[model samples]
Target: MSAPRLRRVAVLVLDGAKPLDVGIPAQVFSTRGSMPYEVRVCGAAPGLVAGGDGLSYHVAHGLEALEWAESVFVPGYRHPDRDDPPPAVVDALCAAHARGARLAAISTGAFALAATGLLDGRRATTHWHYTRALAAKYPKVRVDENVLFVDEGRMLTSAGAASGIDLCLHVLRGDLGVAASNHTARRLVAAPYRSGGQAQYVPRSLPEPVGERFAATREWALHRLDGPLTVRTLARHAAVSPRTFSRRFVEDTGYTPMQWVLRARVDLARELLERSGHSVERIAAETGLGTGANLRAHFQQILGTTPSEYRRTFAKGE
Candidate 1:
């Protein structure tokens, strides 16, 4: 028997939409192999769609195009301070979701989708810069500021500009398979996936001085990721009791000491995997993950892929 045909994806373009975000979903999803998607750009009106940069594009399809799509993607726009989307646009999105079409919002486009009330009580995310505004404007929606995107079943919301690509690749991976998604990423020269919970580019507030004890101890731990360092050793390095150091580290970094260490070790492992040709076992040992099996476990848990696969996909060019 033959495989099913590719799904149809409609990229809903609006007046004042950012061209880059508008193009990402269509570009990524359309490159997934012979059974590639059919991508159509549709506007709320019947003609040219004005872009964020004061340019206009001729859109051949109109709102009717969305009715036939299996999924609909709405890209970010520049003037989100204005609450009103054309009634036509809102109605089309509402109609699409009602008919069971998956709805996706890229960056500030979450504003458009949220305007429809379909995202109420559902987890979503948008650009880190506008997270507060999104939450304030749409109180019923659950906004997660840290994630690259949220896949709340029927609806999806992505973080800033580049994260749109990440969200599209994620959809491809989920709908197709890892190999298909990786192939699309290679074609686009993009990351295969960045989990939804990954931090957005929010600027960290300056850390408070947690006394000299906490400061010295974090530095000491940073230098010893390959060693068997624990909270007890960290407290000693800080010349403080373990209890004090644990509380101070959490206050300073917004994560517990062990959480910070694990993140650091994973980062170290990623660096080694990308910059060097070391086997997973060697990189695992160097990063204090102990064994390749343990490293693979953490890699899959945190990165959503095996270490070897990450290396194959993201390692320095051949």
Candidate 2:
């Protein structure tokens, strides 16, 4: 008997679909690899679909193609005013779900999925800009505005434009394995694996200098992350009392000194995991988080994944 066929993924491109959003899945899933996936693009009808940028896409299949898919991905379009998807499109999605096909939406494409009622009672997300509107319109759906994507067992929704790449890579990782997904990421020159729950484009608040602070102290703390440098140590570096340093640190960076240190250590640990071949123990020690056990704990709390798993999914090579 022949080996089982690869899973079939159908991308539904509607009129006014943003070309970038529609193209991400096709590019990411169609690469030559050990874990290959069959990808197809479908439209309302088998004809040229106009993109939001005025370019026309030659879609060879129509909604009929969805019947055989193992999964369906819907890309976002430009029209937010027209909250409803065409009846044919809605029917195709509902029918596919009824047969146990997984459904995914990228960016504003979530609006289309939400319209089908499949996302009802499920936690999902979209671009922060449209999150409130999506919530108001679909009160049955639990909308989280901060995440990159929400993976409900059978359905998923992603955030804004480039976030589509993040979601597609996540799905690839989950379906294939870390190595195959990393290969695809290298081919696309994109970050192979971003933890799904990472915050999407949250602006970092700049630290304001309190009473009389200097850049010297901040740099000093960075150099001593692996040691026991507390708020008192930082205040000493700045020639101030620990109490004064505490208030000033928050005013400048919007974070307490320890919070800032933890974030910095996490960032350093991530860099080491991605760029170096060092063991988890060494990485943890160098970043000042201590042993591998401590590193794994912090990684899980901050990144929603274990250290080794993060390395496997994001490391440069095998």
Candidate 3:
């Protein structure tokens, strides 16, 4: 039998495009040895398109690429909710979706997809700052403000610039299966398979405690994960009453003492998983979580994957 054709993926560019948003899907879908894809970077106006970073892209293909594509992607633009595309561009987007072309948007790009009326009666999202504005402007589209991304079978929207990677990975997982998606994620040094339904605004930074006294106490807790580590123990180490230490800990680091300690334990366990051939039970004991089963539960709760799965994804020379 004749082989099936490679899927044609078109990325719609526009004036004032966010460069990262444009680059994400283009880089992601171009991974080889996966479901084959032919990526096209197109613009509505068949000429120069400027990006938010003061860079210009010479787009060779016009909106006609949309008509020729099997999937269509829209990237974020400056003031995307306010700077709506020309009627012709919107019509082209709508037409592509109507013809069964899978559609996706990154960050504020969701505004462009929603403007096409294709997102009407469909759940969508944009950057957290603009989600309210997007919903107010297009009452017909269900603007879910919290998720990293939304995948309504063929239509998708992502929350922010980095979340664009998450959404693209989600689309890849659906099309190419877990193994291929994992390979691409490893190549890019990205987290594969983040829950698209999770809140988009989870903070990743845990800065060092502000004051020297609390800093030493934090370090003390770090070294004692295998020992009894109650709030009082930490307070004693800091030379303060438990109540005083708790308040200072929260003020200095924005997390409770125990929370910080738990995070440290998890971090150590994760490093062991990636760096050593240690068993999960041994790693759990080393980190003071006690057993493999306990570590598995907490690891899944925090990282959204089992310890062994994470090891497989990050192990050296894999």
Candidate 3, residues 1-318: lDDT per residue as tens digits?
A: 875667799999987889999999899888355658889899986889888888778888999999999888898889776788888899999999889999999988888888878889999988877876898999999988667888998899988888889988888788878887898899889989664233313333134566665877787778888877999988988889999999988888868887877777888887788889999999999998999999988776665567877777667764
TM-score of 2: 0.63
lDDT of 1 at 136: 88
TM-score of each candidate structure, all chains considered together: 0.64, 0.63, 0.63
Task: Give lDDT for model 3.
Answer: 0.82
The regions of model 2 sitting more than 4 angstroms off are 1-4, 195-318
Model 3 clash pairs? none
Stretches > 4 Å off in candidate 3: 1-4, 195-318
Give the alpha-carbon lDDT of every model.
0.82, 0.82, 0.82
Best-to-worst TM-score order: 1, 2, 3
The most accurate candidate by lDDT is: 3
Q: Root-mean-square deviation of each candidate, in angstroms?
A: 6.4, 7.9, 7.5
- Tens digits of per-residue lDDT, candidate 2, 74-100, equal 998886546578988999999999999
User: In model 2, where is the ten-residue run with the lowest total lDDT?
Assistant: 198-207
